[model samples]
Target: SQQGEEDPQALSIQEGENATMNCSYKTSINNLQWYRQNSGRGLVHLILIRSNEREKHSGRLRVTLDTSKKSSSLLITASRAADTASYFCATPAIGGGSNYKLTFGKGTLLTVNP
Candidate 1:
């Protein structure tokens, strides 16, 4: 089973500021992914970091993984009002051939004020 639970269920910040969210898992995972979902929209894959990787970056987003702690964090730099969305962390489901299945966290609701 894959279990990733995000912390600080909600956050509010102004545009141009930075936002950070954390996630913790219960079991070992091969990789972890972060996703964003706008209100009433499908999820957008943000980033994916493997167990062997400590950190990865994409544009204004940064993600770090610490397997020993079974946690990960997502950092959004220079936040924009358009960036307001719900962020979730996901991990692959257990069992071989289950890579297509993912378990996601409850998510963190981010509100970026313009």
Candidate 2:
């Protein structure tokens, strides 16, 4: 019930463009985190703002949280070709959960063109 589903499983953009991805989840959560995964590489933590945080920014990345709606969005500004990768959102499950671990979705694939 705590699956964070990301939309537009695939996305393509030119260099210097902006990329945005939306994530929705079922049930309640403790906190949500976004991570970036390059081909054949492990996911790198981008940013993590708790449910109480409405908005957070790190460098060119912006994250928004809406607990009431059980949704979130990520925006990457001035994207470069190197930004191409898969992005996923994760949430820690509560209520009948195990150690309150994080569960992630399939993720959205972004392809940035040079």
Those runs of model 1 whose alpha carbons end farther than 4 Å from true positions after fitting are: 95-100
| Residue pairs that clash (backbone atoms under 3 angstroms), model 1 | none
Root-mean-square deviation of every model: 1.9, 1.7
- For candidate 2, give the lDDT of residue 88: 97
The estimated TM-scores of all candidates read 0.93, 0.93
lDDT of 2 by residue, 10-82 (tens): 9999999899999999877768999999999999999998877899999999999999999999999999988
Off by over 4 Å in 2: 94-97
- Give lDDT per model, in order: 0.95, 0.91
Displacement of the residue 42 alpha carbon in candidate 1, Å: 0.5
